[model samples]
Target: MEKISSENPSIEKTKFIKSKGLKDKPHNYCPGCGHGIVHRLVAEVVEELGIREKVIAVAPVGCAVFAYDYWNFDVTEAPHGRPPAVATGIKRILPENFVFTYQGDGDLAAIGAAELIHAANRSENITIIFVNNTVYGMTSGQMAPTTLLGQKTLTTPHGREVLRDGYPIKVCELISVLDGARYVARGSVTTPKNVLTTKSYIKKAFLNQIENKGFSIVEILSMCPAGLDMEPLETMEWVDKELIKYFPLGVVKDV
Candidate 1:
């Protein structure tokens, strides 16, 4: 890529244009939320892939339910934990459309567990962007299926008990075991390097669907400062020290 030298400063500033996938408007997410970073990454990938026109996002109930308001592209709402089922129907109806689901741990791993499993088992040609922030962000910081053992949440004031609460579900591991799943990976946005790797993972997941390879998913370990009741910097450190221990970052499966 060659740099364009122009006497007109206006044209030089145009070198960095806004991504068409994201809308230029105010966001409703709380301060220190990782959703904003993830949202930008998704939008950048869409722009890079040149599939903005053909993309259709399935937003389910959670912090990301109003994603349509932030994204410039087409989006449809699904019942709580029903994004996989909804994406399946939309993709089946219009195979040309690049379909994806944006869901959180509470919605994806808890309520919509069955739907996601079946979708992967059946090899649906769709992408799933799963954000795992440990605790439920929108609903008063409740314990999510991916919440770490011994971690405290609003619902688990005494900390999550391993004996009583069982173990956190490893979504990437579970989905990768399915023969129909073509790609599955886990990444985090706690660091700059990690953020780049997450973008790579997301790009691959989206490519799998665009190439008609089959089901693909990228589970992102995100930070939720408000939910955790910690400072923004503390939340980042906590993600590195605690969150990544349970959900180790890596490519679980990529066929």
Candidate 2:
């Protein structure tokens, strides 16, 4: 530690700092957004596994579409809801590479649902990092396929109606049932402890591929205060009190 004069000698210094897997650049995410935290978690895993240079991330349209700008690694952009299909081709051509898809609810659970389901059912040797923020964050706070039953959005101004809007899709639960998926889990980034656990889940998902286990995916519950029109703390509370009740976080399935 750099010891200074007696004026500041009482303050203790931090001994261990977490790995910064991202580049030194300003992120485009909102102040309270949880994507940034998950991004670091993913990066940390890549660095720890010594696969930074071998990673090929497929990013589709969403708030995190500019993810390539933040991660100091190889990343390819796909059309809306086409990351899984694109990732499949890349992984097949370069089987030695660590290929993964980073998708939001709108990109993964909505239009890309077919691609995601088919990919998992085929037991593709790739990792999927899914971020479920509950709404179409990039398209001006619109209602997405994963929006909660009573959640309000630009389309559902007076709370989502189950009859008219239908129920939110449980992505992990749905994908876990597939025979090809060996590892499927849902985690949250609402707190520090949760963040650490989520990172562990991500690591396991990636390792499953290295070990030739099968397809794996980790869906993360993240906050989007910008789209929710709530303060950061308020958003955190909503995630704990409401969202968790619907999409309970845990290891949905593991083989």
Measured by lDDT, the strongest candidate is: 1
Residue-by-residue lDDT tens digits, candidate 1, 43-140: 99999999999999999999998899999899999999999999999999999999999999999999999999999999999999999999899987
What is the TM-score (0 to 1) of candidate 2? Answer: 0.93
Residue 185, candidate 2: Cα error in Å is: 0.4
* Predicted structure 1: clash tally: 0
The Cα local distance difference test for each model comes to 0.92, 0.91
Candidate 2 yields a Cα-based lDDT of 0.91
In each prediction, how many residue pairs overlap at the backbone (N, C-alpha, C within less than 3 A)?
A: 0, 0
Extract clashing residue pairs from model 1: none
User: Which whole-number lDDT from 0 to 100 does residue 30 have in model 1?
Assistant: 87
Against the true structure, candidate 1 reaches a TM-score of 0.93
For model 1, the run of ten residues with the poorest summed lDDT: 1-10
